[model samples]
Target: MATLRGSLGEANLGRLVVLREAAGLVTDLVGSEQPVFAWLVHALGSPIVMGGQAQRTLYVADADLVPVGEVPEVRLRMIIEAQNETDFDAALAEAAAIIDVKQIDDKELASLLEKAAEQAFLAHSLALVATPVALREMGFRSMAGSEEALQFKRAHAGVELRIDATADWLANWRLTGISHSARHAQYSEKLLPNEVARGKVFLAVLQIWREAFGNAGMPECLELAVLYERHQASMNRIHVRRPVLTVDPKVFRAILRWMQEQEHKLLDPQGDVTLAFSDGLLRLATGNVAYGCAAWGDWVDDCVVVRQDLLALSGPLARARQIRIEQAADHLGINGLVLHRSPHSIVP
Candidate 1:
């Protein structure tokens, strides 16, 4: 996470580039033969050539280097405390006399080094497009949290959300007395947690939907229907022309905030509550209504029964119902409840 800064002379620029390029080539050549050296080049940082025949050792410099008497001063050395004389000799031999320190101006050297550092940073940023997970594992924590990473996530966010929502919809479909197929079940299982790795909101939404309605009436069903529609439109647009995939930062932030709010509401007692069993039916009371379903039957067997004064009381039912609905939509699952509230009507 440490930022690199330094200046290199114009005359030394060629030397630095040659050394870095040679180190890269050497790393590739001896990659299998010398895993440690390869790791030092890619994971740790470029190694510094030091010493002569008898005491030749490749020192992995942890910070920006400035040419000293003969070798650069090592600052905050890494824990990989082994010296590979053979690899060091090979790297030194490959990057031989690209430039002489005595001929380079000090100010130009500093400027060149600073430019080189910037170039290296750009290369690292580009590399993230290919090896994000690997780079992240190699102590590049700041890089993973960079705006570049956020942009990458945003690019695929829409597709990811759609896939997840579709899976949940299919799972909920089975609960509604629709014939269940193995394919539906498999897809639901596979796609359910796709976004959980990215953020907690995805998992939170899924859990709230599952526990509250068991795949029957979803409060957020309308929102998910809309999301799926938007997803289809996006896909269709891709067939005719390349559509830009960019998520507004403000939208992303708003989503996270909403999810956090839903999480808090779902955890409250009044938001969703299981009532005492009546006859052979299981009753769940939330918001301003009481819902009843057979203990063992398809979710389609569910019914919303009127609770005469349910809304009159100043209780958690309304808030709970709203939370359940929002969470259901947020998770992209099927919700059985009709969004409209009609106190005296029975919805079956």
Candidate 2:
């Protein structure tokens, strides 16, 4: 970003002056206040950037996207267009950038950028889906999907390790999506939210490029995540207890049916029906009770009981309210222990 800031932006004038000074082309600025000359020249001249639809924007190369039209020829033509300018070196820089962008003329450049952008989008979306599952398991919640987060639910042995191709692809796609998303963040207030937004978007483009190009710069998302967690230890150190949900998996099926049938009526009492994963079962913790959501541990476990922990939040009284915890439990139908309140107590 700092690398491509000068050439096509408002600072291009100052950047040019600095470059001239560096080349010894300007003699009067013997007392210049800044030494942003050499870096400015190099930044502008780097082949990684292009002027965007907006003035301050710097469009960079996308490795995942192939040019819609003939890119190599377009690259050459880009050189020709900028070659006739007074500053031939600068023209060469701009030309190289155009080549890198795979956009200089008609249908070709746009096509490539778009194709690459779509690929980037897929990668980002995949990453987004995978991350929340991981985070939810670890008793964590993010404001939004972030590429840098290593924070995960406390780990235990009871969880199923089944990885779906969709989930995996979704995770990677999400990483790309976030990177691409960041580039568009500035276009709106709610969209970008913060610097992290743009970083994620651009980072996806970088990731896609890396798949083809040799590894270049890494994304800042990773670094930012590490900093945010303040992790006192390595990922291996986090530990959590596992649950015994599949002792009888039949109840799990009935619970699933109940939930699907009474979707609106059941879940209204529960606040968003949040879950915490503990390897085998997911815990729905409220003020008093923690309902363990049971998924069938295996194909043979037809006797599914959703982790056996709904007694505390159920029964006729619990379900009486239009929006009560019992109605939510009816959907989960998991069989588990409950910590109940006392009815008769004699206090001194």
Candidate 3:
């Protein structure tokens, strides 16, 4: 999360420093007047190339020039936070100044914004892990003997939040609708009333995120998945959209407040959950019925075979209902229909 100062060309060096740091490498800004070539080899212990453009000098590692592999696929949609608001704002201002959005075409502007978001996400994730309490509040327990890895517990709604820099440096968080059974060791979609009564892990984490993100006012898209059953367990995709490219701070605050206040209703099957923005909103549908058939026989003529196929749900209501049903099943264990197919395809 190194902050870039000086001109855009000078900022390129800061970008390299941040990239190297993100890759778990040590870096520092050094004077260009010294014997940079000898210093790079003997002091830095690496071969580096020094180049100048328009009187501005740049130092680049020779190893960095070598191809590592294919570049990681970029995700346009992401939820990110600013580690230091001042530094984040300065970096963004610098990017905007360089892009000259008014003169640039839409495609170029889009590319600039997307790239900024990607960089912010990586910096924010790295900064977040520095504070152990932040990870704990987000329902992540550090993995044994590892600082860069974490594990999600069943009590945390089977939602995993991680940033893996080792593998292609692609970091992401995935939320799934499944939990393990502590007693029977059998995977269950239902929350078993007692589990729900114990602690509201999901609700707590929602508040933690809402507060942690604060009012950065950056445009963000949340990738949502809801579990449903026809004959087999499946996930219904929930699309979150915004009408405008830029989000107002007031609107962002409202969104977080709504999510925090509606925590209970969000889990209720009958309650409606909506994310209201300035010009657009996304609603969470709830309380849809599941239809399927179950049979019992042996391997050739065995029982306990359920076949539910082609539920074919569509629209926001379908997505919301599936999410609500899944949430209820996961937290409260309330939607356990005897004939509904189990989501055993995933063990954890």
The candidate scoring highest on lDDT is: 2
TM value for model 2 = 0.19
Per-model CA lDDT versus the true structure: 0.30, 0.31, 0.29
Tens-digit per-residue lDDT, 1-348, candidate 3 = 122233333434333222221212112223323212111111011112333322112233333332223322131111112223444687689867876856777798889779877655434333212122233334455567875554444322333223221111222222223223433222212111101111132333332333323223211221110000111122123443212122232333343344444445544423332211222332222223111212111111111111221121212222232221221222211122222223432112
Among all candidates shown, the one with the greatest TM-score: 3
Give the least accurate 10-residue stretch of model 1, judged by summed lDDT. Answer: 150-159
lDDT tens readout by residue for model 2, 1-348 = 122233234544232111100111111111234311121122223233233321111222121122223225455445435533435576568767978786467567668668876656444333221222322322323333643332212111222111111123212313221111222221101111111222243333333334423244433333323322233233336753232234223343344345444545543333233334445564544333345655333221112123223332344223332311111221322333232222222111
Ranking by TM-score: 3, 2, 1
Candidate 3: count the clashes: 12
The whole-model C-alpha lDDT of candidate 1 against the native structure comes to 0.30
TM-scores of the models, in the order given: 0.18, 0.19, 0.20
lDDT for 192 (candidate 1): 27
Model 1 ranges with Cα > 4 A deviation: 1-96, 128-348
TM-score of 1: 0.18
Candidates sorted on lDDT, descending: 2, 1, 3
